[model samples]
Target chain A: MNRLFTSLAVIILLTQTWIALRLPKGFYQDSFLLPVLLIALLAAAYLMSRLTQLADRGKFWQRPCQLAVPALFGLMILLVWEAIVRGYDVPLVLMPEPSRVLVTLSNNLPLLWADFQQTYLKAVLAGYLMGCGLGFVTAKLVVRSPFLQKGLLPLGNFMASIPIIGIAPIMVMWFGFDWQSKAAVVVVMTFFPMLINTVAGLRSVDPLHADLMHTYAAGKGQIFFKNQLPQAMPFIFNALKLNSTLALIGAIVAEFFGTPIVGMGFRISAQVGRMNMDMVWATIFVAALAGSLSYGALALLERRVTFWHPSVRREH
Target chain B: MKPQLKSLTQTQGFAVLTLVLGILVIWYIAALLMNGNQMINMLERTGQSWTYTQVLQGAYSIQRPPLPVPHQVAMELYQSVLNQAVTSRRSLVYHSMITLESTLLGFALGSLLGILIAVGIVHNRTLDASLMPWVIASQTVPILAIAPIVVVVLGSMNLTGVLPKAMISMYLSFFPVVIGMVKGLRSSDKLHSELMMTYNASRQQFFWKLRWFSAQPYLFASLKIAISAALVGAIVAELPTGAQGGLGARLLSGSYYGQTVQIWAALVMSALLGWALITLVGMAERLVLRRRGLTR
Candidate 1:
């Protein structure tokens, strides 16, 4: 305990000194001391992480500690990036610093918002719901029929193998240059995962459970709604989590083909062409935030829905 | 040595035939439905009233239907795959080969890098703490969004062809391997770890003998995923290059010319290539795992 506090004090002191006492004439001038300070900070982070991992394993109050480690790591990375770009005078066309990307993101908020709305709020969500819904229904329909199983299940297995690049162009042509085409591509991309997952989940019911239900004279509907759906929740959520990312990917890639001149994908490709690399990075930052948030949201929902699942129970 | 043909029961054969016929019928119906507007436009242009038979006949065999009929795509595919030499630039096979060149190279490099990173993460606590979150964060930035940036920036450096495309593939292919490997290397239970400790095995020895062995199934599964991802990455990489010899470029050109049939042909080609590559990986996985008597 004493050692931990002492180490923490030293870290805080070093960081405070590094921030408070700065001596640099030109912002672009190379600073040897910056790398030295960063190295010291990195070592402190390493020690801090080791101590936390040893002492704290998911204690609720240590949440701040858990957050701090990654935040520090990210901060150090950004600083290094800023340093290299400034010191070496890397061209804007090649790579923009993190600060530049943030500035661009903040300045072009309306544009980013419009692009986000077009891609995520419209195409991605609609396609995700439709694709997963249709796939779930299809899985339900095929569950009892061996014929359907043999037919569609193999097709589902082949689904991931279909490159979206090929599908996107065709989808754009078929559905026209709008969100509908992108949604169609997302639908195509997401359909198979839901189908495969739901089918597997439905079929995964233990024969003993079926026998028990049979002894109770339960109908198929009762057996499914009462016994199977709960079990299938985890698989269903797995498909949802997988599809969330894919939906974003599908919509964005579909936009690259031909769009209404306002979408994440369209902006990215267009901005790159115009040599506005900061905007491109800004759009990418939007995409990253969107993708991660969607993924994280699905995961949280999965945890709630699949609380009974062994995988969930095993975590605690 | 082989499963007998008799294993494929009559019902299975019937189901297969039924599915093919069913898909064909659906394709024909879809073609009719999609071409309705076009057929009406054609008739209006020439001032001819639509006869049901005339429209139906034309719908199934249009020059450029939105969704090409199955037979039309099949015929187009046949011409490109069989009539055109594999060496010909027009051939889907030729484009597929070009894509595969980058895909394979990228998969190799990515797999190597992934394994090295996984090894580092597994052995070093500092790296595990620092790098793991960033690794996860990396994938959240959709590859499609960044692919254009990567291609253009790399292209500006006067780098061309397979290497640049391979880097895109590497960008995608490495993620799954790292995730899988991290999970796999840690999958050895407490009992096994204790057993290794009792034998006084070094870290290297334990990894090779136990952790690596335990990770076989995961490694193979991740390899399949990685290769498939690499194929997608390779295709996407072709997009910014413009008329470059890859399946993606072919699809782009076909789309530009409104060659729906040609686009469908390329789609089939990419689908088939991805399927074949995945199947080969799966076969290798099965063969290796089976040799070790671990089927399930």
Candidate 2:
């Protein structure tokens, strides 16, 4: 069955390429090229399935081949996109081809690098560290006080509910249009998650463990450092992972409202006004990469720090 | 560690005192940081030493040098909602309503689409293979990038107004639902499926009797996230089109005119709307779960 699928996909790909080349000059002018390309692409997919099946064996090669399927699918999408845009003479202003976006990315590497530095390195990292650090410390304080638990949690909830867009302008007003304002927005975006998660994590130590500490007559600080903090690592890491994504989003979106001439959000919105869709896509590509990589790194750190947690143990 | 019952009160009291002192010191430092110009102007306006009210007013005022006072925002919020006509184009209430309409519409459409796609993926291996990765990749394309394209395409086709914005909302909102619903629908145990098979139940019957019921919590969780995402999408859609109504447009105008209070009010209103919508969905989830004896 797998062999059959691979052959079918290869046949489809060949037919798509053939038909794409065979089209008449004026035939490329019609909007129908999109539909034609889609059909041919489907055929190519079917032929590729057959080829995959033919190559399949119970070995390492098969595993890589399995991984390659999605990449192949992505390639087909880009091909179809390019073919349709070129064939139909689609205006670049509307939707630039993927190749153009890549070209733009390569050409403007330095500018993009500066934007990345301003938004990601400066604002996102600074804000995330401050917010998460403050949240962790405050959660410890709240754990010590029933009054604070009652008062601060609700206040935190309220602050979290404040829309980032609403707060961004005020932050710009307060902190100025430099990266500081964007960092402030990231702090606001990140603080609540960290606070809530830390509180939950601190509360999660087993009752038996607390009783054990009580029997030993351990001081409050001793019990917290030895018992509670380790137990809270998993939950703290969860917050960290969440904040990683939130910080990026907050910094970028906050930059949309006000910023100096540099930042990913500024470039994206500005490029769109200029009808430079390719540059916009390239900026987005960078943002997505940054978000995913940050998330991945956090997840890796979580695995290391929470190695004894049940979830990590089970995964291993 | 569990606190000794006797020491609990002392610990609690000490913690509260610490919190209060911390806040006070922070506030004092913040006040001290403000320059002589701001302090003198503040003192001259109030005709007194810097009082809490004056400081708060300074914090939240719409003018430069200080943020809008919370009370000033409260007053503006009051005027925007109570004094102005709810349907008047000039009112924040009207703009909120317009944005809310798109949000709800998009949320519903997106949820339906998400559930349908999830159903297909759950039941059909072919579709699971072909479509799931695409759905994941679709999210990688930033909504900001797509919103303008969607607006332009739909505008050229003369399908402007709420639908284009709603479509964009759906684009963002549906992915979560699809993911959550897929996980929920697949959550049914092997035994449950085997039991159904042993009873010779039809696919439709099995779905209605089992899969749909199993997916409720996941559906509700996704709905909470999706509704907020939908509202965000609606706002973003407005940004690209330069629409003169809706919360997005309100924010844009507020920024343009430097009406910080108006911007703050619109933002507060939208956040309230998002919270309200999520709470409503959560309440409905509770009701449904309670009816099913799933909630305590």
Candidate 3:
């Protein structure tokens, strides 16, 4: 059944693509093939569902099958998008085709690379490190005092909920229109989340474990290192993962306020004004890749650091 | 009297007041130091020697200082919010209302879409496998990077003002809801499912009676996050579009011509707006949970 479904899906996909490509101009107004295309699309979806069902049964193929399922789904979405845009003659400004976006990305690799380096390498990296370091240290210091904790925790929670990105303009004014200002914005954006999470993580140590350590006559330092710090790893990693995306966003948005030249946000806003939707998309592609890569990297690190975490450890 | 004083000292409100006061004092000092440099420069350009007290006063009251003092910002905020009519372009109330409109609209739409998607994912194995990964992946993209494109694209299509901005908000606010709702819907116990099976409950019955109730806390938590994200989205959407009637536009215009006081006022307004929105969500959560007798 699975084999039959796969072959049927592939055939339907090929036939639909061929027919779509062969459709003449003005075919959208009145085309008998439209019903055929719709039927084929539904059939393709049904067959794909069957294939996914089989994928769940076979342990050996599960990983690759799970991966392929989403990839195939993404492909179908792109195919449909292309068809709709072409069939209805949607303007390029409104929505550029995935193919055109790819072409633009490939064509402007050098430019995109420069923007990536400027935004991601300099601003995001510097700001993430500094902001997270400050937050962790502050949390450590504040955690020692109940008074400070009571004061800072509520403040931090309030500040975190507010749009810290609004500080982009103020940072630009203070630090000037360079990568430094963007970095400043990122620092402010990332700091509170890290502080709040680190505090919560440190406070999450099991009281039973603490008592156990106390019975062992553990010193404050020993108790913290052996109990609290290790227990906080997952929450710290959560902050790290959250900050990874936030740092990118802060840098990009800050660039909107002011930047020298050649940054992801600059390219996006500039190309957007010129109605170069493809270039804007290509820039977005780069930003998305960078953001996901950082997030994925942090996630991998989290699994390694918190391997004992129930969420990390699999049944196997 | 002794007990009352001790209780007051131990209260969260007291802690907050202490911290806010501490922040204000620090802010004033920092403002003096920062703005003093410009004051000194101006004094030198005028070729006049200045006393420390005179420079202190000048720094505290200078228009367009690098950092405005708290009082200056407060005054500006007060004037903009209360002095002007709500319909006036200069009123912070008007700008905030515009932003709030988009934020709420997008939030509602996003919550509906997220709930629908969550329900679909829970019911259909194919959608669960295929769509869940993309939902997670969508968040990693720098959403602000696309704000300009979305604004312009929608603008070209004759969809301007709040709609384009709201679309961006919906894009942002939906992710947290989808993740939270999916988790909530799947959180029912195996024993509960077994009980439902013994009773021969239909899928819809299982969902409405068991799954939906189980998901309430998660939905409220995600809603809090979503509303704030929606506000951020509305603000950023305003930035790209250069719209004249939103808090984002206020920030941009303030930035353009060196109106530090205006920028600070707008920032404070947005923070207040976010706080109010989150409080409203909290209230709703409380009301809903209490009505259902689920609150502990």
Q: Output per-candidate TM-scores for chain A, rounded to 2 decimals.
A: 0.86, 0.79, 0.90
- Per-residue lDDT of B8-52 in model 2, one digit per residue for the tens? 655645545666578657654564455334766767787876665
| lDDT tens per residue, model 3, B89-174 | 99999999999999999999999999999999888888987887677667766777677667766777788878988998999899
Each candidate: chain B TM-score: 0.90, 0.80, 0.91
Query: Candidate 1 docking: what grade?
Result: acceptable
Error of 1 at B215 (Å): 4.3
Task: Write down the lDDT of every candidate, Cα atoms only.
Answer: 0.79, 0.76, 0.83
Top candidate by lDDT: 3
Cα RMSDs, all models: 4.5, 6.3, 3.5
lDDT of 3: 0.83
Better of 1 and 2 by DockQ: 1
Candidate 3, residue A167: the lDDT equals: 90
Off by over 4 Å in 2: A1-5, A14-36, A44-59, A129-159, A193-245, A296-316, B1-65, B117-140, B182-215, B292-296
Candidate 1 per-residue lDDT over residues B1-296, each given as its tens digit: 23564355435666667787888888778778889778989898999888888888888777878888878889999999999998999888899999999999999999999999999988876566667666756776778667666776778788777888899899888987887687677766667777899999999999998989877876886787789889988988887766369998887888888888898888888888888898899899999999788664
List each candidate's DockQ score: 0.41, 0.25, 0.47
Query: Per-residue lDDT tens digits of candidate 2, residues A203-296?
Result: 8788899999999999988999999999988668767865776687788878887899999989988998898988988998898778766765
**Can you tell me which runs of candidate 3 are displaced by over 4 Å?**
A19-33, A140-144, A198-238, A301-316, B1-4, B45-48, B152-158, B184-215, B286-296
Q: If scored against the real structure, what TM-score would every candidate get?
A: 0.85, 0.77, 0.88
